[model samples]
Target: MRIGIPQGLLYFKNGRLWKRNLNALGIEVVTSPETTEGILSDGIRHSVCDLCLPVKAFFGHVLALKDNVDCLFIPRVIRVEPDAFLCPKFIGLPDMVRAAIRNLPRIIDTEFNIKEKPEAVFWQEVRRELKGDRKMLLRGEAEAISTNEILRCAQNDRKRRNDKIEKDHRLQKFSEHKLTVGIAGRPYLVLDNYLNKGVVRYMNRLGVSVVYQTPEKNYIIETMSMLPKWIYWSMGKEVVSSVRRMLEDESIDGIILIANAGCGPDSFMTELIDGTLPVHKKPYMSLSIDEHLSDAGLQTRIEAFVDMIERKFKYN
Candidate 1:
């Protein structure tokens, strides 16, 4: 059976793993096309008026795939790890889609709360919900885990190689005109080109190198330890920790915070990050995006932010 996976929300983070698991189970997966004006428009048309931009985009993705697939895999992810939860929207996403959208294929809205149950249990629940073969499910889980480990190691190795290269005096001349700016936000907003109106590419065109990385686990723990209160949202911790890391790094010239216009967690996280910036004395800007945001306006603001950074570098 063809199962459709929408390219939105947690899809940015867990899409690969989900695809790997399903493909290994001998199922055909049909993913919606990348975000486009049409897709976002479709999303906005069907979704509630108050929904965040990402959720509206997600609705569009679901509509894109509803007709092509026999079923949809939109899991209700509550807690992936202990002591942390996803946003309230994510916990209620499947139901929201059901309520808002009409005439959808069968939804595989399995609840995934690894905090309460082991990951193996979660997989078993998914297998049962999908009616997938038990052996194939186990095989898929194993393969996904192995692939994740390899990718993690490769990313670490590449980061180390890049660090070594950055330290070399020969490459310093090449970076003279480039300003490294750290863009911190939810993966969905930061990584989705159409959703963010190609901000990363625009920054590149303006001679600004953008960096967005998930900080290592130890670094996240260390950074969050200094906060007055713990961040309970998984994505919030990542954004906070990554921003802090970028602020502390002397090589990164500036930082930008990207957030959906109505995201509650982001509202708090951005303020928390902003409070720390005065001490670091780093140039920072926050971009709040919605469906109504204009491409030209975003570009103009980015150009101005980059100009300010360039002036700071020149005078300092």
Candidate 2:
């Protein structure tokens, strides 16, 4: 049986684990194509009004593999990192896809809670759903867990070795170039092009260098210190952690936060950020990303936010 994996949303975090696990279980997997306009169009056409752009893109991926694959791997990844749940929309994604598609494709349901000893629910669910033998399933589980640990270590190493990347960027001495604006947000927002109105292009057109803010030493330190003790949500941590680091770095002139509408934790943190930003480097704006593209008000907000930052720091 063929399984379809979407390249949107949690694809980056789970790609390696899913591929390795399923392959070991002797199941063939198929993935939706890279993000493109056609996929965006498909998503826009089928998605609900309240759905976010990334959720829409997710539907686009599922729609793309409608007939070709036997079952789709649309996981209900509510909590990948302990008590920190994924976006609520992600929790209901399976139901959304079922409604959007004419023929509800078989979906392999798995709940990933990192707090529960590393992919335990995942292996249990996968073993039952995929119908793998005892030995095969056990081996796949061990291998998959090991792969994640190795990846985590490598990510840690990359953070340690990132001095070179930082030094090179610093040495460039971009005095003569366009403004360098840092877009610091969750991976879903930063990586998603359609959701954020092609932020890279938008920033480049405005003569701005977009800085990527993923977690590192500076990011973690700033997050642990700045974010409130009660903001224990995982995705919230991702955003706050990066934003803290971005604020500390002098190289990042301004910061942009792109989040989904109805994101509870984001709304709270955005308020916290806006209220507290006056003390830090203090150039920051938050934009809510949704599937509805016809909202002119949203466009105005984005334009105004960008323009505000540009005007404030243009001469600096």
Candidate 3:
């Protein structure tokens, strides 16, 4: 069967595993095109203003595939990697998109447990759902998951390495170039184009170097564990550390957080950052994007933020 997968959200982080597992079962997948003005425009036309850019972009991808494929794979992240938190929107995106779309297709629900040794719980659940004889399901589950894990590990390693290289390249070129901008957001929002509206390129246009959280995944996750015990939220720890590191980096003059309108985690942490980072010699700003892709609005906000950065860097 031809399965449709939206290329935003968790797809960026989990595509390799999904592709391998689906292909093992002889299913073909169709993916939405990368994010562009057209998709953002459609999102603006179709989405309510209160939604965030990533969710709206998600809505656009669903609309794009409404008639184009047999099934749409929207996986609910009950949780990824056990204790690491995903935004609550992730848990309900499938149901939300299902309600919004006029047309619907079959969906593959993967409620797997990954923290319990090599995805044992997840594959057991997957095989149970796949409709095969007892023996066949067992064999398929064991083989498909093991293969998927190896591939995912290798690919993640490559990504981390490439991120390091990119960081090195940027530092070499911009060490003396002087302009700097701090970027704070969820990894998905900051790195995925279909989600963040190409803010990286826009930052480049403003003659700024990006200080992002991508290069510090392990460090961020590690430091997240250090947050006070009362704050049980996993994301808060990570965002706090990410912004703290950015503020301490002398090369970063300002920070920008692109937040989702309803994302509870970012909404709380970014406010703390906006209030306090300036005192630490790092100024910050946030632009929440949902469906409003009107160039006039985006450009104006960006221009104002850029002006703030310029003024601060020059005077302070």
Candidate 4:
């Protein structure tokens, strides 16, 4: 059977896992294309104005895939980790899509909460949905998990190598023309070029090195310890910890915080980052994006931010 996966929300983070798992189960996976104006407009048309930008984009992706796929895989994700929970919207995403869009294919809206149950329970639910053999399901899940772990290890190793290279270069001499900027945001907003108006590419074009906040387990624990209360949202904790990590890095010249217009967690996380900026004495900019954000406007603001950092580096 062909199953469609929308390329939004947690898809940026877990798309690979889902695809691999389904593929090993002998299912054909059909993914929606990257975000484009047509996709965004279609999503906006079907979605309510109050919904966040990422959710709207998700709706668009579902529409794009509905015609071709046998069913859609919009799992109701609650808590992946033991300590952290996802946003409320994610828990209701399947319901939201069902209510907002009509004339759709069968939706495999399974509840995936690993925090409460074992991983085998989720796979059992999937097996029931697909009516697959138990042994095959077990094999597929084992392979998928092993493959994901291998990828994670390789990524961590690459990051360590890059970090070492960056440290060695810093000790040599600082480049006059280049500046490093840390970007903190949800993967949907930061990685989707169409949604963020190609901000990463624009920064690269301006001769600036861009660093993304990928928080490690130790970093998250240490950073959250400083706060009075815990960050309940999983993505929020990641963003806050990433911002803290960036602030502590001497090489990061400035920071750019990106969030969608109507995201609640983003608002709080940005505030927390803002509150700590004074202690670091770092220049930072927070950009709130929506369907109305203009490419020219975004580029202009980034140019100005880069110029200010260049001036500070040249003088001080």
Candidate 5:
């Protein structure tokens, strides 16, 4: 059987694992096309005016696949880390898709609170949908675990790169032609070139290297341990924790915060980061995207930000 996955939101976070596991189970999986102007418009037409841009974009992806696949796999990812949960939109995403789009294929809406359930149990939930052999399910579970470890190793490699940058104080000198700027926000926005209007590429065009909000997962755990209060929202905490860690790196010259318009949790976190930007000599900017956002405007903002960083960091 074929399963359709929307290429937005949590999919950006877990798509690799999902694709690897389903393929292992001998199930064909199809993904919606990347977010684009046409997709965004379709999503906006189908969704309520108040939903965040990423959620609306997700609607578009599902709608695009409505006629093409046998079933849609919209997992209700409730909790991944301990004592934290995803935004309400994520928990209610499948329902939103069902209400917004018409005549979609069977939806495999499995709920998972990873903090409360084991990996085996989550696969078992999928097994109920497939009714596949138990041996296949077990094999898929093992493959899923291996996939996760591989992703963790990649994150560690990123940490090592960051550490190298930190040790080279000369790299922090603004006079250097190449500069590294840390971009922090939801993975959906950071990872989606269309959604972000190619901000990462634009940065590269400006001779600036971009570092994402994704730190080694273990580093987030370490940073969280130092906090006096536990963050209840997983994504928000992850971004903030990454920012907190990145702020200390001398090699990171500036920060650009990308957020979806009308995202309450993101708004709070952005403001918190804005108000308490590190005392060091780093500039910060926040860009928010909505259904009506224009790429021209976003590009202008990015250009201005890059210019500011360039001037400030220029070797004296």
Candidate 6:
């Protein structure tokens, strides 16, 4: 069967895993095209005004793939961590999509609440679909995890190589000095070039190495233990933990959190980080992105932040 997957929201982080796992089961995976103006327009037409750009983009992706695919895979992700849950919209995303769009392919929405056993939900839901292929499911899970790791390693290597090249070129001006900035946001906002308006590129051009909130798996797990028990949103907790980790790191000169306008979890995270970081005296900037946000204003704010960091730390 051909399964359609929307390339938005959690897809930025888990798309590879889903593709790998589905392909392992002899299923053809059809992904929606990257975000574009037409896709955004379609999404806006279908989605309510209050939904964030990423969610709206998700709707667009769904619409784009509904005609050709046999099934649509939009997981209802409840929680990934123990005692923490996902955003309400994320948990109810399948329902929202069903309500917003018209006729579509069969949606395969498996609820993934990893707060209990790691593979309990996977085994329970996947068993229903692939009743006779227990071995395939096991193999797919392993392969997906391994594939994701390989991709992440390759990305980090590429970032390192690019940073070295940029640093070598700027050596004469600053003697190999570069500011390290930690970026905190949802995976979609952090990774999507269109959604973030190439903010990472801007930071790299400004001679700063950008460290995302999601670090090595072990590092994130270890650092999360330091956070307060009340920050309960799964993604929010992770972002906030990353911010705290960056704040504790002496090499990180500043932090810029990109929050989506009207995102409750992001708003809460921004406020939590803003309140906590002041005690450490670290430079922190929070920028909100919405459909109304402009490229010029974003560039100005980023340039200003970079300038302040440079003047304060003498880093290039």
List, residue by residue over 96-187, the lDDT tens digit for candidate 5. Answer: 88888888888888887878886557766775676543434544444444434544544554445444432231222333347788888897
Query: Where in model 5 is the C-alpha error above 4 Å?
Result: 132-177, 225-228, 277-280
Q: What TM-score would candidate 2 get against the native?
A: 0.73
- Write down the RMSD of candidate 6 (Cα, Å): 6.7
lDDT computed for candidate 6 = 0.74
CA shift of 52, model 5, Å: 0.3
Model 1 per-residue lDDT tens digits across residues 1-316: 7889999998877776677566655678889999999999999999878888999999999999999988899999999778899999999999999998999988988888977886556655665676653434544444444434444543454456423422321223334447888788988888787887788878888877777767877898887788888899999999998888888888888888898787899888888887853534788889988776568988888999999989986998
Q: What is the TM-score of each candidate against the true structure?
A: 0.85, 0.73, 0.73, 0.85, 0.83, 0.79
**Superposed Cα deviation of residue 96, candidate 1 (Å):** 0.7
List the candidate 1 regions with Cα displacement exceeding 4 Å: 132-177, 277-280
- Backbone clash pairs for candidate 5 read 174-313, 175-315
How much does each candidate deviate from the true structure in C-alpha RMSD?
5.7, 5.6, 5.0, 5.5, 5.8, 6.7
lDDT string for model 6 (75-179, tens) is: 888886677788888889999999999998778878888775554346346435643434435444433444345445435643554234223223223323378
Q: Which candidate is the best by lDDT?
A: 1
> Which has the higher TM-score value, candidate number 1 or candidate number 6?
1
Q: Candidate 2: where is the Cα deviation over 4 Å? A: 24-26, 36-38, 44-47, 132-178, 216-229, 277-280, 292-316
Residue 25 of candidate 1: its Cα lDDT?
50
Q: Which is better, 4 or 6, measured by TM-score? A: 4
What is the Cα-based lDDT of residue 135 in candidate 6?
A: 42
User: Quick one: RMSD of model 3?
Assistant: 5.0
lDDT of 2 by residue, 112-178 (tens): 5667656644665665776543333434444444445545544554445433333332322333446
RMSD of candidate 5 to true structure, Å: 5.8
Error of 6 at 122 (Å): 1.9
